[model samples]
Target: MNEQHPPGPAEAPGFWLDTPEHRQWLMSEAERQWTFFAASLRDGPGFFSLDTAGNPLSDDTQELHSTTRLIHAFALGQISGHAGADRIVEHGMAYLRDHHHDAEHGGYLWALRGDAIVDDRKLAYGHVFVLLAGASAKMAGHPDADALITDVSDILDKHYWEEDAGLFADEWNRDWTPFSTYRGMNANMHAVEALLTAYEATGQDVFLSRAGRILEFFTARIAPAENWRLPEHYSQDWEIDRSYAGNPMFRPAGTTPGHSFELGRLLLQFWDLSGRQDRNMPVTARHLIERALKDAWCAHGGLAYTLEFGGKVSASTRFWWPVTEAIGAVAALIKLDRQASDEQWYRKLWTFADTHFIDHIRGGWFPEIDNAGQVTSTIFKGKPDIYHSVQACLFPLTNGLSGHIDDLKHSEPVAMR
Candidate 1:
């Protein structure tokens, strides 16, 4: 609106996926998403959760994941050469360093109320995003990135990484005491993403090796074993805990198709990062992705939230993230195979997202949609952050699994904004 050009769709008849103008449309979409959340800069250091209309919500407690994700998102903006993005990234870096980082405790807090600690538990789920944000910020040349990266990497290695299990432990108390023996696929999945990103930025093989160990446990072992409906909860020994249920919104009892989608994408990235040594990587990724696509996609429109252990729909409520991860997964497939079915599925998913979840008038996507195809926020309040939907638009624009947005300029310049 101000200095930026108005966002507009490409002049195309059919779906944008695999189309000649898709690159341009994707850039436009990225710009729209960035501009929408960039408005959060007005709220200052402790980034406030944004509503669908791009304003700060009434709830002012900023979660650590949200803070790190904003840093990651705005860093992507910086990498892509978005104007005024440095301000956003710098603001986030300052906030993360000042408020969220527990200087004495040696890990980030879970939730903060106006620079005060609310839930101070150090969680791998939140810490991985800290790693991700730091990695992305390092790529963007943020001044504070290296410190954050070193801090989180130390914490993860010392506290969370279990050598026997080859996966991260879920949670710990403030001073690194044992909170629980619980382990989860959700945090490990994101840890893979963060570790891979860290490897990409640092050129460190330890990060790559750690990520591979995790992929071996899940992708090589658990994925095909479970028929690609990846279980969410796990025992301390990394065995599937079929009876465990914690947070319905987070730690659900059944398998999450969204996670399969994420693992599919992350596994492919690991494979590519590993120099494509294992020929089975693509096959495993395809099966996991295709299995999720087949199992969770409703005949009505959007992807279901979670599935029962036997692959029936456990929770039919559609959330924005699964669709975002689905976009990433199918886009990853399109990079290697480019099947017509993948293309069609990609377009179909976008059509559903644009029709239901996207807020054209504002900028952010609605976080949830009910069974009747109406936008609802029963589980999540307002739009959480620009992380998932931003990736849905930006990640697809890159050529390979790495999705280095710094290289986005070399692609076709069709941002008809």
Candidate 2:
């Protein structure tokens, strides 16, 4: 008798619903999402986080709450032709000028109270978004773009850089002491991205150098150890942080495919910068992406949100942001290696569009999904977050519009020697 093999977990079905029909559906859906987002934008400083039922989440200092949402609104408004975007940016500019800037502390506060500062400490993620918001404001031709960038850059440079580690400090105390014990690949990755955007917007050599240094940081310190594909969290001295002091308690069961996929695209940028120096950059990127697709992705539908450092499998799925980044990364790869590209990558991207990120039933991309791929959970699902929308719109549009994958467009690389 012949032995039969079961479907290995590695070959498990993935959730992707991409098709020509789905593309049409996504475009239409994008339009609808834009309308919903535009309607949420406020003319004043305050904003609200709406639940699935469309009720405002809170009312206290709601205007100051507008900063996060405004970033997403500005990006979506541009893509969807929503008029509220103008007001959103306008309000954001005024808020940045009037409230966010901390002259005494030398960085923007995470939040502001009425004529007082709230959450005076700064988060790496929030500051990156502020940088992104500044870039978006510039794109929108807002007058405050220059000042916003300058102010945010001042904050970033003064407080975030860990000179010995040659990377960023994730969070700062009120006096701007780098206080976070655990440093994250995610935060550093986005800081590079934000700095790149700022460099693009301002053509400032300082920003470009900072971005390049971050790229080097990822290559040198962020990627995982042998047999590992995910990035490691570290301390200021670059020590692996198993203590969970500053890291999240719930580690994924395997390498995070979405993050790996995003890293692949980021590698392409670095590769482009290293052109003529090494042709293997793209090759290495291609292999990493293949690993992500093979081990980290699920076949039934939706990209897996988290992966264990040791490549162990997990049941978690249904985050929309990773899907968005996966799509953008693969799209970018397609543009870069069109000749050597496989059609399946494009199909994989489309598949995600159909299954996890798309709200085929109730509309808009659902925020959270459980392990079994069912959309039943809504306790933290489908909440309107400012960060997700901005990333969703910007990553897609950036890859969609460029159609080119060359990094020669970036500034000169920093000299690390």
Candidate 3:
């Protein structure tokens, strides 16, 4: 949900106590889950969503967005030394080549059926993910990497960019005229991420320029005033429509927690790189994150998918990917030696896992957790959907594995040691 709601103190018994036995157990569980998810990648272009029976969600339409998510997972796999990142990307390249791509339109379609493009509408959300896949293929030194990237970049620059206002539109017609009213934080954030990676691949000034323009758009147009501290979601012209604010798809009441955490991390990175002063952006982003964290965490350790203003917070029982990004943002803040409360945020992760997503009773972590921290869904688990597992697993593990805790180890050895 909003990620602001800290789980109520009324958590399930024995959550996030950090006992050595529990730490070892959870670490092992994490590794096992990674292995299981990695092995699920099949002969074709996609990975299946696993359920309790170990059956892959075979329907092609189910996970059209896995392209980006898989790339993210592969990156995480690389970071964690899973040795399967290459295989995962290979499967993705095959899928893109075999099924998902629409050669005529110069972008990817959503579904595949034995070498034929199944759904050709071209989701803007999916396009951002394809950028990730294209880049991942490049990093893996796949044969089609350069060609894939150039094609995706052309589509993005041609269709997604708003040359008049210097920002990308969320969706478009065949000629790329803007169509969707749901201007989204998710879309823009992914675009920013994709463009940065694309720039890394090709070092094209044009790609970097687009990325910078997005940062500037957020800074000037979407950023809230000092007192309000909320992200603006709207057209490139910057209107305040309800459609852009409080989307209900991810969260029932539609509070934007992920965006807040993402913006905090992105702004921190931008500030470090540019040294340009924005007196209020950082403060506002931090406030949004803290607020989201407090609101999104459930009574137990599991997280609510999103926060809604009109009703009780809506949460899923299955765990989702934003949890890791949220944790990563907090860890980055901690690394920056900034004054943000890392312990509080970090505790939220452990607490949610312990109470909800960890599946201490079953095996492997659940893909989602409901309000009470019980497994609600397994829609995104299994195989190697890019962003889902890698972001979720690696972000928390890396913070631990990276020796970021060295300072605590030395100073607070009595407890942490």
Candidate 4:
């Protein structure tokens, strides 16, 4: 007689994804997010941040991440065959190419106020998103995709990449002067994401090789020594910078578990793309993912913002992006293998999101809420981002655990999501 394993959630009788009700609900949420964000384009080809009432805020300053994220979001809409996705893609691409692109400096500018350049720093954090927008638009079949991809790829190779360190340098002044000796894992984490997306788009081994180097540096080498809670800051010599702290929201003092979740998911994607070459990788990814969930998941049914390097809660405030990123990470684990714990965490995080984060009327997630479940915004305000929450809903619907969303439109379609 064969020993039996208990049924995971996906293996249960009514746990089918192809069911009309399930598919419709998932796709509808994804579409709702897309439709809600389309309002940002009301001012034509520039950026518009939205307030809680779904009204565009007074700020006209556009950051590279914000613009590129919108282009990436709508590119997913086009990838999923959502109607009118092309309009937003075209709009965002035009703004990105025209205003954000530095004609004098060659790399994208850091920020813009209307047509004027404000803060022309060439940051790797921002440039990776440009590459992401390019890869996403390329996958979506946008006309300007190739040009964006080629330009950004060349910039990254020429300016950002460090061959000996096997990682990208952080920032530079407008005319390519050295801005700082600072290095960061946040930007490099997202670099893996954009590089993987580029590899998927162009089948370029160079992208894959560079992404692997970053992964190996952080995950395979650094993470194990740090007890799987990756550090956020680093010196020019790549030493851990525990004393460094800037931007409470972005570059917090201690390690960020949210980034661990993201890096874990990216590792899985890297493993998949490499045809599962290394047997040790999945274990490494799992350590990163589960360690984050264990360290950050609070009693309030949400995750804390950041944790100390020793696994203590450094910042107690909860934010929306961490939960969304964790959801994406868990969704990937479930896709890779429907392990019982992964399935349970998947359901648990979605429950928390539905209970606290999502705004049923407005269609996008509320940025933050207190432990009592009352809406709060001490740090984050408005519904400015369409990238994180939307992908949390969209990733589970895809067959592959990687960032690719084309599966929703092609390859053994379950529903036209």
Q: Candidate 4: what lDDT? A: 0.85
The whole-model C-alpha lDDT of candidate 1 against the native structure comes to 0.84
**Candidate 4 structure quality by residue, lDDT tens digits, 121-197:** 99999999999999999998888889999999999999999999999999999999999999999999999999999
Q: Residue 173 of candidate 4: its Cα lDDT? A: 96
Tell me, by lDDT, which candidate is best.
Answer: 4
Give one digit per residue, the lDDT tens place, for model 2 in 1-417.
212111112233331122333333333544445545544545455555565544455543433235744663564455345445577667666776777766776666776644666677777767777787787667656777888788777777777777666677787776767565667766677776666656656667676567667766655344534342655466567666654422232233234667677667776765554342657656766666676666656666666665666555554555666667766676566656563344465465555555555554434566766766655554343355544533443343333222111221121211110
Model 2 weakest lDDT span, ten residues long: 408-417
Where is model 3 poorest over a 10-residue stretch in terms of lDDT? 408-417
Segments in model 4 whose C-alpha atoms lie over 4 Å from true places: 1-20, 411-417
lDDT digits (tens) for residues 251-321 of candidate 1: 98899999898889999988888898899899999999999999999989899988898899988999988
Name the lDDT of candidate 2.
0.57
Report the C-alpha displacement of residue 56, candidate 1, in angstroms. 1.9
Candidate 3 lDDT over residue span 267-305, tens digit each: 555454334366565565466567667766555554455
Better of 1 and 4 by lDDT: 4
TM-score of each: 0.94, 0.78, 0.75, 0.94
| Model 1: ten consecutive residues of lowest lDDT | 1-10
